[model samples]
Every structure is written in C-alpha cells, then in structure tokens.
Target: MSTQIVILAAGMGSRLGRSLPKSLTELSDGRTIMQQQFDNIHQAFGKDAKVTIVVGYKLEYIIDAFPEASFVYNEQYDQTNTSKSLMRALRASSSGGVLWMNGDVVFDPVALERAAKVVARDQSFVSVNTAKVSDEEVKYTTDAEGYIRELSKTVKGGLGEAVGINYVSSRDKAALVRQLARVDDQDYFERGIELAIEQNGLLVEPIDISDLYAVEVDFAEDLERANLLFS
Candidate 1:
C-alpha cells in the first residue's frame, strides 16, 4: 500500500516563547524542524511520498516553506487541539494508509523507516521511547501482547513516551475518522486512537525506538535539550 504523510503543525508554541511556529523553529543544524522532517521522510520513503501539513499558527510560514505539500488549515486552532487539526488533515488524505507525525518532533530518520516497515504487520502502530520519559510526555501502557492498553498524558505506570508518530491502514482509516469525530474538540488525537482500540478493536502496536534520538519540541527546555542532542 502507498503511504501518505500527515503532519500536525497547527499549535502555537506559547511555552517555547517564540514568535515562530514550533515546526519552523530552527534546530542546531540550522534546518527548521519541518525542513528536517521533510528531509527525513524523503530519505525514508523517497520523493514520491505524499505529504500533507496542517497549519494554523503563522500558516504563511509553513506554506512558504513547503510549497509542494498539501495543506489543511485549522482556522480555530487556538480554540481546538491536535485532534481537530489531525481530523482536518486525515479528511484531506486519500484512502490507503498514512504515516502521521507531530510537526514539532525531531528524530533519527531510521525510526521513520522502521515505523513504515513494521506498521504493515498490524496495520497500525505508534513509536515509543523507553530510554527516558518525563511527566510531561504523552505516555502509554501496553498489554502483555504489546498492544497499547492506554494512551494519554495522564496515564501513569506507562511503558514509555509516544514518539508522536503513527501509522493507520486504509481498512482502519474510516474507523479512525469516525472515532476522531466523536472526540472532544480539545482532545489530543491519541484520544481517538484510544477509543478505536477499545471500541473498534484497532490493534496499535508499539514500536520501541529508544535507541534512536527522538524528541518532541514543546517547550523552551525541550528545544534546548534537542539542540544539545543534535549539536
């Protein structure tokens, strides 16, 4: 199946204390997070991979940066959350399968290639990092079989932090959209995945990527930490 990429980049990086959108923030290497993400995806899937970026906060910058990418705008981005932004992007995608990533994440390109290869087995998967997890991370707990049991920021006694990357197959895409439509506007997209896992029997396996460098840039400290790691 063909794999499309959907990036959620609508959030205002209020905690980062930056005027620029988090995805546009430059890494220590001087490439913006979005630029690095595009390069990494290209390296993993080649130039033909269809990429859609959902933009809201400073939409012009993202548009200018990725003129070739398809875009879905979230006009109410300030009032909504990632779930809403993701819904917009998913709705715009053609059916088959999609690899979704949070636009502000930086990671080893190998992780993307691994996720793309392994996701076909289960038709759904989420990358996880067990090496280090802070309380601020979006955590998950897996069942004995390695299927995600619960996923949320408040989930305690979790296995690891989710690396903000996921894959959903065409068979499950409609169901995922339905689940997303049922969630609160303020909910994270993972909330919809949690519901799909519980009610629709969607098997979202966890792909451990702890050995690889991956970080979600949310706050100023996260950017500092990412710079330290990538510098």
Candidate 2:
C-alpha cells in the first residue's frame, strides 16, 4: 500500500504572526518551510511519494504556492484545532498509512529518513525528543511495554516532548479517526491519540530523535532557533 505524507497546515498561525500559512515562512536556506519539508520528503522517499496538505487559514495562498500537492480543506479551521484537521486528513487518505507533521516545524530531513523504517514496518509511532521537556509543549509517557501511555501538554512527569511528527499504520488509523472525532473541538490531536490508547488499547511507540533538530516555529524565538540551524 502506498503511504501518504500529510502536512497539517490549516491553522491561522496567529502566534507566529504570519500573514500566510506558517509553513510558507521562509528559511535562511532559501526555501519556504513547507518547501523544505517537501524537499525532505522527496529526498527520503523519492519522486513517487504521495503528498497532501491540509489547508484552512489563507487556503488559497497555500494552494497557489503548491499546486502540485493534494489538499484537504478544514472548513472549521478558525474554530477547531489540530484534532479536527488531522481527522480530515485521515478521512481523506486513500493510502494504507500516513506520515504526518506540523507544517510549522523546521526539522532536519534526517528525521524523516530515520522514520521511514517505522513506515516500512507499518507500525504507529510519535516522534519525540528526550533532550528537553517544556511546560507548554506536548509531552509523553510510555507504558511498561514501551508503548505510548499518556500524551498531552499537561502530562506529569513526562519522559520527553512530542516533536509534532507522527505516523499511523493502516491497522490503527480507524481507531485514531474515531477518537479524533470524539475529542473536544479545542483539544489538540495528542488528546485524541491518548483517548485512542485508553479506549482502544492502541499501541503507539515513541521514536526518540533527541539527537536531531526539529523546531516547531511558534514564537519568534523558536523561528530564530530553527534559522540558526541553517546559519
């Protein structure tokens, strides 16, 4: 079954203060963040990789910017959160699995290359960084079997921060789609993942990428930090 790489770019990105989608934010490497992401996908998976973008805020701009990719519109982009947007992507997917990431995250392409192993095995996983766990970022804890247990911004004694990149195997996609739909409108997609784990015993592995550089470009400081990687 073919795999689809989903870019969740529907948010208004008001915090980043960008008039366009956050993924369109340019990097010092002379590529927009999404372009870098596309390049990384192309490099890692070759030309045959199926790419999809979930667009909402300033959807036209994103569509115009990347006319080659498939798109899904999140009609509730202004009111809903990542959970809803992700649900839309999963619902629209024709592939056996999806490898997805935050549109705003500036990451080393090596992370995706490493993650391809899990995609090959058709396993579900969430990319994580154990180097630092911040209060406002999504954090996670694993079960005794090393599968993800709790996942959210408010998780206590979290092992590390979830890096906003993830995968869902074909076998697990239905459960996630159900939970994402059941989650609160304001809840992040992590909440849906947690619910799926609790309600359906979904076993999601945590792939450690602490050695990598993947920054979600949220605040001005984060953008600076990500840009510094190119400098």
Candidate 3:
C-alpha cells in the first residue's frame, strides 16, 4: 500500500512570532520549513508518497505554495490544538497506515529510514530523543516490552522526549481516532496517544532518533539550531 503522509500545520504558532504560518518560515538556506519537510519526504519515501497538509491559520498561503499536495482544513484551528488537527487527518486518511510530523520540525532524513521500517511493518511508533528530555516537551517511557506506556509532558520518570514525528498503523488508527476525538480541544495529540495506549491496547513503539538532528522550530533559538543542520 502507498504510504500516507500528513503534516499538521493548523496551529497559529504564535510562539514563533512569524507573520506567515510557522511551516512557511524561511531558513537561512532560503527554504521554508514545509519546503524542507516536503523534500525530506520525497528523499525518504520517494515522490510517489501521498502528502496531505492540515491547514487553518492563513491556510491560503500554504495551499498556494504547495498546490501539488492535498490539504485538510481545520476550521477550528484557533480554538483547537494538534489533537483536533491530527484527528481530522486520521479521519480523512485511507485504511492504510500513516506517518506524520509536526509541520515546523526540520529533521534529518536518516531518521525516516527507521520510521519507514516501522511503518512498513504496520507498527505504531513515536520517534524519541533520549539525549534531551525537557520539562516542557512531550516525554515518554516504555513498558517492559519497550512499547510506550506513558506519553505526555507531565509523565514522571520519562526516558526521553518525543521528537514530533510519529506513525499509526492501520490496526490502531481507529482507536487513535476515537481517543483524539474524545480529548479536550486544547490537548496535544500526545494526550490521545496516551489515552489510546490505556483504553485500546495500542502498542506504540518508541524509536530512538537521538543520534539524528530533528528540531521543532518553536522559538527563535530553535530556528537557529535547525538552520545549523545546513551550515
């Protein structure tokens, strides 16, 4: 089955203080964040990979720039969060699995190799960074069998931080969709993953990507670090 790719770009991303959508912010190399993400997808999954971008805040700009890719608009983007954005994407997807990422993340293409293997096997996974576990970032801990047991920012004894890259197999998609729909509007997509693990027996593996560079450009400092990958 063809791999379905989703880029969640609906949030206002006011923290980045960019006039355009956060994914449209240009790097020093002159490529927008989404532009780099599109290139990385093509590099890793090939040009045949189907890409769908979730848009809301200034949706027209994103639509106009990447007209070739499909789009899903989250009309309540101002009031909702990633949970709703991701839910919409999941609902719109086919029965096959999906690999998705936050729109602002500029990541190393090498990480996609592991993600591809996991997705090909129909295993749900979350890319993690054991080297960096910030109190503000989404963190996770694995079970005895190495499946994600707890995922959220407030989890105690977190083994690592999730890197804004994740996948949902065909088997677990419906459970995740239900959880995402039941979550509060302000909740991040991680909340739904955690709930799905507890209520639906969704076994999500945590893939370590610490050795690779994947930066979510949430702040100016983060943007600097993301640009350093090209420097």
Candidate 4:
C-alpha cells in the first residue's frame, strides 16, 4: 500500500513566542524544522515519496520553504486546531495509508523508520515514547494488548507520550473521517482517533520508541532541548 505523509502545521504556535511558524524555526544545524522533517521523511520513505503539508499561520513562508510539497490551507486555523487541519489533509489524500505528524516535532530518522515499519505490518499504529513525560505532554494509555486505550493531555498515569506521529490505514480512514467531522473545532486530532477506537473498534497499536530522540517544540525551552537532542 502506498503511504501518504500528512503534516499538520497550521497552528500559530503562540507558546513558542516566535514570530515565524513553528515549522520554520531554525535548528542549530542551520536547517529549519520543516527542512529536517522533509529530509527525515525522504530518508525513511525515499526521495519521491508523497508529502502534503497543511498550512495556515504564515502560509506563504511554509509554501516558499517547501515548494515541492502539496499544501492544504486552513483559513480558519486561528479558530481550530490539529483535528481540523488533519481533516483537510485526510480529505485531500487518495493513498491507501497515511502517516500523520504534528509539524512542531523533530525526531530521529530511525524512529521514523520504525514507525513506518510498524504501520507496514499492523496497518495502523501510534508512535509512543516511554521516556520521561511531562505534565504538558500528550499522554496515552494502552490496552492489555498494547493498543491505545485512551489519549489526551490530561490522561494521568498513562503509559507514555504520543510523540505526535500516527499511521492510519485506509481501512480505518472513513471511520476516522466521520469521527473527526463530529468533533469540536478545538479538539486535537487524537480525539478523533480515540472516538474511532471506542465507537468503531479501530485498532491502533502503539509502537514504543523509547530509544529514539523526538521532541515537540512548543516553548523556547523545548526548542533548545530539541536542538540539543537532534543536532
């Protein structure tokens, strides 16, 4: 099955206190987060893999930075969240499987390959990090069999952080679309996944990536940490 990579990059990233979009934030290596992500995807998937980036805040900057990537603009990005941006990408995608990611994260290429491998085998998967999880991170709990049972920021005593990468097989795409359509605009993309799992019995296995480096650049401190970890 062909895989499509959908990046949700439409948020303003107000917490980062940066004028530029979070995806455009420069790493210590001189490459922007978007550039590094593109390189990592190419490393894992190949140079010609299909990638679609959803843009809203500073759309022109993202467009100029990744001229070859197909973009879906979310004009109401300020009023919505990742769920809405992800819905747009899902609607635009025609591939049998999709690898979705939050644009603000930078991770090891090996982690990306591991996620891809899991998706290839299981058809649907969520990348989870067993590393130290802060209170602010998007946490999740898995079932006895290791599938995601619940996912949210407030899920206390959870297994680990989601690490902002998930794979959706075409088998589950329609259910996910319906669930996303029913969610509030402010809901996170994982909310839709949670609904699909609860209502439709969609199986999303969790792939542990404790050995890999992956950080979401939310605040300035996170950016510094990401630079140090990924550089």
Best by lDDT: 3
| Per-residue lDDT of model 1, residues 1-231, tens digit only | 456899999989788888989899998899999999999999888899899999999999999989999999999989999988888888888877788999999889899889878755647888999877678888999887889989999998987899899988777888888889899999999999999999998888888999898888888788888888767
Report the error of model 2 at residue 130, Å: 0.1
Model 2, runs deviating above 4 Å: none
> lDDT rank, highest first?
3, 2, 4, 1
After superposition, the stretches of candidate 4 with alpha carbons farther than 4 Å from their true spots are none
Q: Judged by TM-score relative to the true structure, which candidate is superior, 1 or 2? A: 2
What lDDT score belongs to each candidate, Candidate 1 first?
Answer: 0.88, 0.92, 0.93, 0.89
Report the lDDT of model 3 for residue 72: 96
TM-score of each: 0.96, 0.98, 0.98, 0.97
The positional error of residue 117 in candidate 1, measured at the CA in angstroms, is 0.7
Clashing pairs in 4: none
Q: For candidate 4, write residues 1-231 as lDDT tens digits.
A: 456899889999999999989999999999999898999899888888899999999999999989999999999999998898999899889958789899988899898888778767647888988877678888898888778889889888988899998988888998898898899999999999999999999899888888999988999998899988976
Colliding pairs, model 1: none
lDDT of 2 by residue, 173-225 (tens): 99999999999998999998999999998889999999989999998889899
lDDT of 3 by residue, 42-80 (tens): 888999999999999999999999999999999999999
RMSD of each: 1.3, 0.9, 0.8, 1.1
Clashes of each: 0, 0, 0, 0
lDDT of 4: 0.89
